[model samples]
Target: MKHRWLLWFCLLLPWTAMASTVQATLDRNDVHLGETVTLNLRISDAMTASTPDLSALDHDFEVLGTSTSSSLSVINGKQSAELIIGVALRPKHQGDLQIPSLTVGGSQTNPLTLHVEAPDTSASTHTGQDVFVEAQASADHVYLGQQILYTVRLFYAGDLDGGSLPNPDVNGAELKQLGNDINYEAVRDGHRYHVVERRYALTPHHAGSLVVPSIEFQGEMLDRGNPNDPGGFFNPGGLFGNTTPVTADSPEVKIDVQAPPASWGQTTWLPARSLTLSLQGLPGDNKLTAGQPLNLRLSVDAQGVSGDALPALSLPTIDGATVYPDQPKTSTHDDGEWLTGHSERGFAIIPQRAGTLTIPEITLTWFDVQSGQKKIASIPSHTLTVLAANGAPAPAATTSPSAVATSPAVASSAATPAIAQVAPAASSPTPWRWIALGSIALWLLSTAVFAWLYSKRKRAQASVTKPRIEPTDSTRTLRQAFLESARGDDRAIQGRRLLAWARAERPGLRNLGQVADALASDEQRAAIVTLQREQYAGVSAETRMDLAATFAKGFAWQQDNQAGTESPLPPLYPFKLD
Candidate 1:
């Protein structure tokens, strides 16, 4: 009590000249925790300034920063300087707080009251038509780093020019837009309104009362002109086309963001309303054999989160099967106010030998926000049947009189010049018969050897150049290289891989540095430097990039234009004519 009086007395210090009047003000009278409010002291008709005593707010608010400045002006030889002081304060508790009176150079400003409320966790219900907004969450509560759907709905009956909406900037939170805004006609309180709804998947970084402020949108609405004196060529009755300035603001919301539970030990913290994993393009009626490639697609769809937040998934390795995964594709979709995210990845799985192959199940752990418990989403496994090669019977052979008659003629036609040089063994009867039989045997043996070598070569090339897309698409190949490097492929590994890709892409291009200098601008020089450093430098260094997006931004390695790679998963959701 004595300290408060002393601080007020210090602020109320008397001055010899009483030439100034003081006033105290606040940017916001009501605030939540972690929200900083500004307090300003305006002093008019003053010469010099003195700092105000702010010790009264010390018990309730943390003073983040303080500043003071004065404006000086000489108007017709009469000089005046006004001192302005500002302080930033964050609430320390949830209740009413006071900004005590302050005095500076014979000027005393009155104390002001501030209301510090806990985070607002209430669902807003609105039926207004005049450009109003309301916010709601998929779940009222969530754990830290968990997914929570925070949606903002803007309801207006007037014309909207499809005005741009900014992403919400909430404190202590990271948010991703679920998808594009949706506009539709909605009825509320017997009145029709054109609604523009936007949604976001918000993940709170801190465990506390998460207070999200109101979302405000300012835009122009169409309106008829008001005229009593002015008139235009088309304004006989005055109603052509003019726009009025309008604004909409959604109510502030408070969410109870909780900490992870104790039972969820050694699991990822994913708080979501619901989650699902769908595996498309499973082995159908088609028979499987050794070394045969099968395309597989795994898609994960989750509610209350953006697709970007989902963890990367991989198929469990089977000894008999080879797994080749492509880069994952992700997208977010919205159905009205509700949002869903989808991520898909395609894999080329090849069974090494004919046997019963066991593919293991996958499990994803997440917090069930509704139940306030940990939930595990499990994907079922599969046991595939592969046929053996040695068990199949060889094709049967047959010979006839016409076949024998054509044999010598066919051999003579296929014979090379060297073989034709020998005069068909003129000394013996049926001399052409021996020559034909020998030529046929040599041709068959050479063909078998050539076929074996070709097949082996193809398998080796497939493993070395596991193309992200068809080998023909240069941009996709470049993007795949970028994805590989971005996903923590060792620097040395990326260097070799991209070099190999460059050689395959152009066939003639050898020097990557020369290609980079010719094709890319100065902005891309950094990526080139990274490549060189990775190839030559020994110590490990961190490097990151958006491979596909960079390619779109003119980091193109172009050949001739080619079509995009065909999607591995045939349309499982095929359209029906019936």
Candidate 2:
């Protein structure tokens, strides 16, 4: 009887857990005075399709919006479905507040608590402030038409989700969101912060104290103890998790702006604390021969600054050289109070002309956060020589061709290199036997030297140029690769690859909604969408053939565009190299 009872209890454990769980987690738990926050309710099992009761939250919170997303997944070979319901809330008042419990199916969640603080209105707030949205303008003052930076930050110490947040409205300034929202883990004020940070690159409109208006948001908090029911406390949800909803608000913030200095001409926008400039390849090393390609890399490192605010670095134009900007990446870190990170930019340069060409000084200028002034750092000019295609020098040499042919080995072994005769062959008349023999030897030596130089230049050029293609080109290439993978009947790999490609390609575009936005033409976009859904075996081979043709056409179009002088692609954004 005891053994049978234990078996039954074990069998019923899972059913008991399934019947009692209704989990809830907000996007942020802390908020400021007027910030809106999102509260998500996740139900473990299927429940009646009805909104959970949130009427108890009327005193401290107001609902702004609600959205729901449901997903079903098979984990460890067990099927499970999750229903995620979200609510946008705004705080009604400041100080501690409580959110009432919510019931889903037979399970209930406990109340949630949050703290809301007033915005700092004092002049003493300096560069740091509590519960404020502040913009780090790269320049306090700039000349008209000069570029200035405006980076907005929302800082606070309360539940973030469902907290009343105000929409950022910068009427006095020109603002542009750099890209999609950036979410990362940050450690601030000795506390580990999991923060959702966004970046934007803004150029002022008219220049002055451009005031970015306050943003308001709402969220939920839990009531600690009920004063009316001292003997019997009422928790709507239960003991396990908070079902209550409360609201919070973020403080209003302002920025002081000014005009650019008149002395600085129409220079690049430089909004940073400090910058480090570097030149990767030294051309003076005699590493290339005529008709051979050599690569040069330029990199910049900026710290105590905003990575997105980095300006483009202009390199000196070397004749017979081709240069292109490589796609850039930026890495940022925030230690609670201030954002401190490095932004790096790299360029690939190919030397086509063979001669001693001077690469002039490369300069990077930015606002010096430490000195509160403008500063510039530069890498001085350098010169390089490109030998003749035949592996011979332009200037005449006195040494015979025979001796010149043997010079390469001697230069490799000896401390000093021997100079050979460079006079015209017609001018120097010697015995035919010596001249013929020496000329043949010189010709053979030149072939071998040119071969080595070509190989070396090829390797160097590949290293530098490859980076320019991979980040942007890889995605388009994957579309074809994914089809190839599926052709081989590799559904799993194709599925994963398609998902990854979608993620990369989606955010890269200016807008989202349809796959056509990613492609240059409507026909190509339609083909890609059809191809994306072909994994279920319902798509015909004829359809697949059409997709393949469409991909080929699209690829050819991309290559044509890339080769043309018109740069349809977006301008180079700020990036960092790890």
Candidate 3:
């Protein structure tokens, strides 16, 4: 409590010393020819005040612009008001000049002096050191399939006023831009200044010493340092208390890119910080029933280091079962600094037959940025058990009648027959002594014959009412749809639909590969091949149509396979000829 009162008393002392005080100050003491300097005047504890006269300095300087901003701040529970006025002035010559004192509110500030020098005139210096910018590539050495990082920093210690800066250009490598520019306080070589840094993720096409050439940019420099204060070593030169402009060339960096190892045993080299290959719902012990479909899912993340690196993902060989390869979806992002970031890919796999199954291990290779060596990582192999298809058990053998008669309990039961039961005569014929048995047999045979005859007649009558349709019609209809889709709207979509129709119309084709090949013409096949390439190609309607058509044909073929038989004959109806 005593300290607060003491601070308040000290602050009140300033107001008492100078009533209704006004002060004027300049951000810079010097201005260059064609360059502007700012002069600021602040007024507090007063209202409706006029700005101080700058006409005295106007003779040697031109007023370019002026602005005013007011603010209120509370410190230590006391409110203070501040009104700031700024003037941008351009000097008339490259020589020492004085800015006269000006009054605001009631008090005035002392005069300030600044020195400006002539601009550098060398053409090479102007182009190389003065205005041009270039981005330098780092990590020149890298392994094949490995990633290197290249950072482009804009350096300007000289006159950069009125010039423009563009995003640094990087060519000759796969580049992924690191998020926003980094801004922080940095002291380089004992000189404290605000440094801006930007980075990119780069994957070398093939390992060799790769050059990421420089990028050029131009920007104007504002004289932000204290012009009159010579407190710092890198401050205004001592001779005349004058400040000079600084310009820098874009630093070009060379990286030693290492090549991937020649021997990656049964493993695709995936070098990344973190990677995961999990088959969702995979039997915990990789067990499966015969004819059950298997789904394998793979995910990879490598955000820690620079690389387009990823671990290989694959299905282990399951005995007697067909394995279908899954297409992968991949994506990447930069995690900022020393880390190239990561990407992920997913796949789906189905099992055909049952038995013991083994999924192969997936491997990825990359150059370790920290260790400066190439490394390979992998997703481990998996084993699965598939049970047999048929669920029936074998039957057991029966015991003979003779064996039963030899048993003591059976003989005793037979000898001690029931008192009410009558004994059969020795000469009696077998119990088929009734006429009803023959009559019933004859009746059953006659009924079966009549039913068969009636069924034949019914089928013949039905044939008269309905006619079989030619399978060619369905095939032709699908072909036409495919053709129309090719020329009409959503060609790719329509094409795929048509292919499905064809597959349904004809079941003779076994797999997707056969169906796609059989349904697609040579031109359509080429278009389909190109479509995969164009899936990630730059967006365009024409390209989209082409891709759609390509996929449509393949999928359509699959649909057609489900329709029924491969035979071109008309479908048979349960009816007789008219």
Q: Which of the numbered candidates is closest to the native, going by highest lDDT? A: 1
List model 1 lDDT by residue over 21-100, tens digit each: 88887755665554567787888877557676778778888887778888889899987778778887778888888877
Worst 10 residues of 1 by lDDT: 557-566
Kindly list the per-residue Cα lDDT of model 2 for residues 1-578, writing each as its tens digit.
Answer: 99999999999998776663677765545565556666778887653346777777778987876778877788899877777788777777888877767887667876677776663332244233224434455555543333344444545443443444343566754454544443323224333333345554444556566555545434444343355543444444332223245433334444455565666578775555557888776755645675665556666666544555455555777665676766666665543323444555455656654566567888777666456678888898876676777876655534664565566555533422333234444456566549878998999999999999999999987655533233467777677676676566554575565555555555443322233443456676665566556655467666653544554433222222333354578768747658
Q: What lDDT would candidate 2 get against the real structure?
A: 0.57
Which prediction has more favorable TM-score, 2 or 3?
3
Pairs in steric clash, model 1: 120-254, 121-254
Residue 337, candidate 2: C-alpha displacement in angstroms: 6.5
Estimate the TM-score of every prediction.
0.38, 0.36, 0.38
Instruction: For candidate 1, give the lDDT of residue 135.
Output: 78
In terms of TM-score, which candidate is stronger, 1 or 2?
1
Candidate 2 deviation (Cα RMSD): 26.3
Clashes of each: 2, 87, 64
Whose TM-score is higher: candidate 1's or candidate 3's? 1
In order, the Cα lDDT scores of the candidates are 0.69, 0.57, 0.56
- Candidates ranked by lDDT: 1, 2, 3
